[model samples]
Target: MWLKVIKFIAGILAIPLMAAVTRAFYGNIVGVVELAGILKYFMWGVGAYIVLHLLFFKPMFIYVLGHEAVHAVTSWVMGGKINSFKVSDKGGSVSTTKTNAVVELSPYFIPIYAIILMAVYFVVAYSYKINGAVFIFLIGFTLTLHLVMTIEVMKIRQPDLMKSGYLFSIVIVYVLNIIIIAMLFSLLFPSFSSKKFFADSYVFSRDIYAVIIRQMFF
Candidate 1:
């Protein structure tokens, strides 16, 4: 009970951080818009996925498969022994000997499908000289797939969210998503560095918290 209470407080405190990260994401995009070479391929891939989504061609089964696989993989990474794993078009579940915030909430944050795609790219690159554009396009495609599914799933009550306290789960998921996406952007776009991202995040967080403090006290 006390642990849940602590998580609740931490969750509330994390709102400022989430907002800051979100601001940094927008700022990062604005910083780099030179669509000449590789960036164009990335944008093309993003646009393609957007088109697919609009046509109601969502691959829910694929999302569910990757989602449950992440749960099982994260459990193993955290020293938990998996008992059983099941995934279907409707939903998925994984049972492990260990349970924690990381294991339970990982599917929401970790883009397992992206990692799988990256692995495939690496393997192909090892043998053949993979084009930079192809790599960027694949990253863009898989990343969109992960982000879209994550947003849709978060709309309703999830048992995973309940375990970690829904507020805390959401804060963690949102903040991690922002950070992960920002890191990927930084890697792909040299002009938009992570250093600038952190600086912007701090400024945004400070201003948001300042406003909240003033509202409460002044």
Candidate 2:
């Protein structure tokens, strides 16, 4: 928890550093134009992203499954039993012996790791003018997964963590942002089912994390 607080502080401190880098790399106006293009890509990227997740990316499903598995396994390892685990096309959950800090956190961290891996891939894809299609794939996949996983992480049950008022408030604000973004995505792309999209991603993270934590700890 203290580590996370420090990370949060470091992230806040990095804003100015990022701003300086942006100014250095591309003067303000140019930076703005570049940023605009990236933003525009998001809509097209959204379609590409959904299609990839819905079809091409079996690894993403495995990662999500591992995430939930971590949560369930961790709970059991910490002396709790999983009463039920229900998986579906949309989403699923595991009713456990009980919730613990470590167990609850499993889902959150697995997605963070997955996000980092995706970030690395995105950086590499963009760095080299690799195929435009590849860049599109990386961008779409990473953005959609990152956004949805963030929603799930913030949604997890964590009363102990919430007892720290600061963390509790932060969670509320973060989840609200996730909700707003998801709504915006839904409005922009009416073809996808917002509820199913969010729920599936959420469950995937939790179960995959559960399995990971269970393996690591046990």
Candidate 3:
């Protein structure tokens, strides 16, 4: 009963969370648009996404690996012992001694591949003068891959969502993905700071909430 109540509350909160994220996303885009020469690199990401789809490079194996890996990693971080980890082209899963919403739902929100690519980009860029175009292009490619794979996985009835209650899971996933998308835009545009992105979101959310209250009471 309490769990259901919590889920209901989470469902309600999801609306405002989504509104905040949308505001933040718009701000990130506006910041990117103001920067010169950055749009081309971003387009390279879009182009890479188009080419991958055209070539039918689904790479289901890698997706499965990352999915299971995220589950295992989060489980371990939560002080849980992984009993088994398996990955296949068809699907993959991780079994742990402990389970919670965070461990169960993390794979859907955290883009492990994108994070790895960012680390590699930093390392390689530090060692050599890498071409900015290629670096941004690869970032775009990997992030697009993550987004596609995430959408594909979510289309079916995922056991993880069942374990973490559908409403709660969806809310968490939606908000996190929005933040991730905004952060990616910030990464692409050096002029944008994540702090400002979040601050703008807070202000936008506050104004939205004030308007909502006025509509309900006034």
C-alpha root-mean-square deviation, each candidate: 2.3, 16.5, 2.2
Residue runs of model 2 more than 4 Å from their true location after superposition = 1-33, 49-63, 69-103, 106-129, 146-218
Q: In lDDT terms, which candidate is top?
A: 1
Sorted on lDDT, highest at the top, how do the candidates line up? 1, 3, 2
lDDT of each: 0.85, 0.52, 0.79
Candidate 2: RMSD to truth? 16.5
- Top candidate by TM-score: 3
The list of candidate 1 runs beyond 4 A from truth reads: 33-36
Model 3 local distance difference test score: 0.79
Candidate 3's residue-wise lDDT over 81-173, tens digit each? 999998999898788997888888888888888788877878888888878777777777777777788878777859888666777777788
Deviation in angstroms for 99 in model 1? 1.3
10 residues in a row with least lDDT, candidate 3: 30-39
Clashing pairs in 1: none
Q: Which ten residues in a row have the lowest lDDT in candidate 1?
A: 31-40
Question: Stretches of candidate 3 above 4 Å error?
Answer: 33-35, 54-57, 184-188
| TM-scores of all predicted structures | 0.87, 0.33, 0.89
